[model samples]
Target: MTVVFVLGVLLVFVAIALLAMALRPAEEAEGLNRSLAVIEAIADAPKELRKDLEKPFGERVLEPLQQRALAVGRRISGADAEERIRRSLDLAGNPAGWTVDRVTASKVIGAGIGFSFGLLAGMVLTDALTLRLVIAAVGVVLGFFAPNMYLYQLAYDRTNKLQQELPDAIDLMTISVESGLGFDAAVQQVAHNTQGPLADEFSRMLREMQLGMGRAEALRSLNERVNLDDLKAFVSAMVQADSFGIPIAQVLRVQSSEMRVKRRQRAEEKAQQVPVKITVPLIFFILPTLFIAVLGPAAITIMDNF
Candidate 1:
């Protein structure tokens, strides 16, 4: 049994080493090929066009740094790093120039900055090696995750705005459909009339459909991007209705009604939690201040009498 276990472990280690060796050469060759292509293009281009084809100084300088940082990030990141970051970027409205590569580089840069600052602060505040190491480690962790945290906040705020605007958008669509407009026209109306993430998404969906994509596929893309339960439900209903040849107007009406009800229920749920949320502050802050104010003068007087 021991021999079999030892052999299995050796085999696994050998497999991993072989895979690393195989992949490393491919990555190196890809980088080399890109450099060669750029050199060949530069050599073949006319003088006038060569100036235009040449990259900016900043780009030339940052490209190598970004590659290094990206390497570091990939080493530290999980297998799903690209997809996860892409999904986050989508949820965050896909901010301009914020590609997965840039985000990956930022993670490494952030960690480096964080570690430097943490070590400096630790040196100033303490001499203990263990404490300094702990602080520095904490800084590294925070720095590494800062980009992700920012993305999460952006996604959260955007999702909330989408949820809040959805019911109104649905109502508008329902009215337009009832007034004899086609479903796509109603969606265009929402896209043009409303504003915010929902409007932007609808506009994109319209574009997708106009570019020969199916309505159901466009809607599924929208749903995947938004990550809102209400939006998901609405998309599913619309897809089902389209698939079964049901009336779009009736489907819009049902969704609009449900949106209103759900919005109301969400409001009520938040209202009901107010007291529970306040309890912590009441106990830790307000009650103590009140007791101090009420009892202090009486205690002083009693002390004088005694």
Candidate 2:
């Protein structure tokens, strides 16, 4: 009887331990669910509550912060912004005009957009004060320099367009010269007929020449303003031909043919590069899809059997 009693006691203790283990997880899970529900409630709070939460801590806290931000804007705006941007553009050999009002407006727009995106992203990703502050600082810096970046992009695009149009302009100039027009007349004709950055530049050069600047000086100025190697080469060729009394028509014909050949070779080179560029996407995106298509069903069947 004693042996049976001890055995029954052991079974009871085992049952109790098992019951405790089973209930522990449920209790913990319930607590976790409650915590999560609280968090969701906080997140889904009304817009007014959110605004109140986002408001600056107090008048003492917000006043200084507002003053500092205003100071930053004033410093950035007053630091020779126009001169700096104009010099950078000039160094890039772009003669496009930029206005002070445009620059200021661009900076303001950039700052606003940056601040908004940074604040929204910070709220979405984290609730950490340090991280939010860092994001805001970065946004402010980016915004301060955004106008300069935009101007650089514009200059680069304009330069590229002019480069692409140069060969065609040269070809047309050659045709005009070969048809018995003078070199200056051919350039004027190309400038008048074409509508692009290059044509505009040529038109400017022609105007300078008409205003008593020597042909060579006007062409050199055009070369400097455009800052294109091809234009420089053309200028050098013209200067040498003029000095050596070479036929201008012959010089134009030779340069036009060479330009066309170089253009064709560039096209071929880009075409060849396309296949190599496609290989990376094929390996990363296409191969994985193919593997999934081929092996997925077989793997599923094997797992089911196991």
Candidate 3:
């Protein structure tokens, strides 16, 4: 009976030792896991951070405000307005960071500013409520259309520049083609050498061609974007030449000569109009100054003598 009791106590001690051994690794593993989690959190602190906290006021506040303004403008504007704006943008060479949304938002902002200024001016200038409201309404109209007017002016100026540069660009292409480069290579040469909207357009057209668009289609696309009659003619000629398998060098030479003649004619026409353009200033300004100088002394002498 004493031996059995001793054996039973030893068995109990063994079981407790086994249980301790089993729990030791698990506790250590749990602590290691917690440490690893802490290390990972420390390592990923920057990546897990909110990026908006570091952004500028323009991006965080102004951008959202602009977006809301854009929504309002879009709701007020119809499809035709958007299309016209898009067309104008394309013609303006799509100025950097200027989008349809931005322009629309700008319209709203401009109108608000104009309205405020007009109200202030009216308060300072007039006491009548009707006249003040009229002035404010006029200001609103002007402000609302200001962006459109600016865009139209930009598009017109760009178109004029493109027109003026086209002849030179074509001449360069002609030279390149005459020097044994293929049509595409000649276009690339022009794009690389020239520095203007013409070169920019050529580069875009070349990209379109490279990206699996047919040459004729690319030319048509360029024509549609440019909104110039001369460019349209050039595009039509190129498309025809491509369709008929005509040698591009000959076409380019002919086009270059035509462009030069047209440019000379334009210069001469402007030269002829110089006299007409100067007439108003000559009569109203120069002649008036001369008359005033010449008559002033004589009139003063007569008045003094009489």
TM-scores of all models? Answer: 0.79, 0.64, 0.81
Stretches off by above 4 angstroms in model 3 are 1-55
lDDT of 2 by residue, 192-288 (tens): 9999888888888899988999988887777766656777888889888988999999998888888788779879999999999999999999999
Model 3 lDDT tens row, 1-306: 999999999999999999987788877989999999987876677853746456878998998989888989999998797888888899888999888888999999888888998888889889999999988888888888898898889899998999899998998899999999999999999899879898999999999999999999999999988989889988999999999999999999899999999999999999999999999999999999999899999999999999
**For residues 18-109, what per-residue lDDT tens digits would candidate 1 score against the true structure?**
99887787779899999999999889888888775577977888788889999999998999999999999999999888999999999998
Score candidate 1 by lDDT.
Answer: 0.94
Q: Which regions of candidate 2 are displaced past 4 Å?
A: 1-84, 87-97, 112-120, 304-306
Question: Each candidate's lDDT (Cα)?
Answer: 0.94, 0.79, 0.90
Cα lDDT for residue 174, candidate 3 = 92
For candidate 2, the 10 contiguous residues with the lowest summed lDDT are: 91-100
**Runs with alpha carbons beyond 4 Å of true place in candidate 1:** 1-64
True lDDT of residue 11, candidate 3? 100
| Residue pairs with backbone overlap in model 1 | none
User: Clashes in model 2: which pairs?
Assistant: none
